[model samples]
Target: MILVTGATGQLGTAVLDNLLQHTPAQQVAALVRDEAKAATWQAQGVSIRVGHYGDPASLDRAMQGIEKVLLISGGGEDDALQQHYHVIDAAKKAGVRCLAYTSRALKDPSSLANHLMVRHFQTEEYLQASGLPHIIFRNILYMDTLPLFTGPTVLETGISLPGGQGRVAYALRSEMGEAIAKVLLAGTCDNRIYHFTGAEAYSFTDVAAALTELSGRQVAYTDVENEVLAGRMRERGVPEVAIERTIGFMTDIKHGQEDIVSSDLATALGRQPASLVEGVKLLYKL
Candidate 1:
């Protein structure tokens, strides 16, 4: 059976949904920390296995009789690396034939310029050394996060961020999830690394223009200093780690870390990925 970790999460749930379209529900198993959150999966005849990255025993149990595994990277900075190690170890013990991971798309993942990139690189290195057949999806920034960065209403406040003229190849999370499902269903280990990115890159300036055209309102892109934005996020009670990570992402973009475009995502789905404007319109109902 194909087992998916973090099955209740947005991307994981989307992946499972797409996988179900290609294969039988009985051929799928969902590894979720909370069985309560997986009621829908269970109702659809999916095997619900309880597991957490922090608990190696639970992970081992969750991989029982599973041939292939999709390991969605865990959240948070603290202990996330260790948690991934735990999962890798358990997967190794369980004799899983193939393992796929969602990782950051960086030219040199080993460069320690950003903490998030560093963690992903570390995990990638560890996974490579584990001797398990693996596939790595080096995913770009998710368009789903656009709503979060845009704040409550883009039409009213416009687009404001610390990134300056930095372009991101942002793909819809659901599309990327579909590509991942295709990979899992094909069960191919020949292609080790795949960059799942949008067909084009866009900056906040482009975002503003698109919003203006879509909403028929005068929207603008305001560039704020990193410190100023971080301070504002802090004043608004955003967590310390979140503020730092947000600022770090903007910094990475400014340095051109996220300016990448790839057509592999389209090739996997056998169709073009949704454009940014189309995704935004659907997201805001514009």
Candidate 2:
């Protein structure tokens, strides 16, 4: 059986949906923290296994009879490392034949200031040493985050961020999930490390232009200082931790950590990945 952890999350749901198209429901299982949230997958004939990353016993139960496992990276900047460690140990104990992990594609994942990147780097290293044959999908920055950066009032406020000329190969979360599903269904791949990203890279300026055209409004890209953006977020009552993380993302982009273009996604899906403008149209309801 192929078990996918975090099956209820946005990307996870997409992966499961795509996986169902290629494989029978009887061969698929979903590991979720909340059984209530897994109702949809359950309705679709997917066996739902209740488990938490923090609980080894639950993961053990979930991994029963599972040959291949896809470990979705858990959230949070601090406890995620430990959570991933727990999952890895449980997968190893379960005698899983293959393991796959969702990670970020960066030139230097370890050297990044982003807390999430650091945790991912640590988790990748842990997985490497676990002695299990593994595949690493180094996903690029999600196009979904573009909406978050532009905000809901972008048509009125324009695109305001600390991101300057840095370009990002922003693949849609759904498409990335599809690519991952393809990889899983293939049984195995020749390459261990897959850099899943959009076919084209776009700067924030390019994103702004696309938004303007899609929205039929004069949306401008305003590159502000990190401190200025932080102050604005603070005034809006955003938490300090969140503000710091968001700013760190902008800093990473500005430094070109996310400015990557890879055909891994297209190669996996056997089709052209959506461009930033097309992603914006769907996300922004344009």
Worst 10 residues of 1 by lDDT: 106-115
Per-residue C-alpha lDDT of model 2 across residues 143-241, encoded as one tens digit per residue: 998888888899998988998888899999999999999999998834399999999879899998998999889989989999999999999999999
lDDT of 1: 0.88
Segments of candidate 2 deviating more than 4 angstroms: 189-191
For this target, which candidate reaches the highest lDDT against the unseen true structure?
A: 2
Model 1, span 1-286: residue lDDT tens:
9999999999999999999999999999999988999998899999999979998889989989998989999898489999999988888899988988999886555442467667887888999999999999999989888878888777998878988998999899999999999988997886388899989999989888888889899999999898888887888899988888898888888778888888889999999898889988877778
Q: Candidate 2 — worst ten consecutive residues by lDDT sum?
A: 107-116
Give per-candidate clash totals.
0, 0
TM-score of each: 0.96, 0.97
lDDT of 2: 0.89
Off by over 4 Å in 1: 110-113
The candidate that wins on TM-score is 2
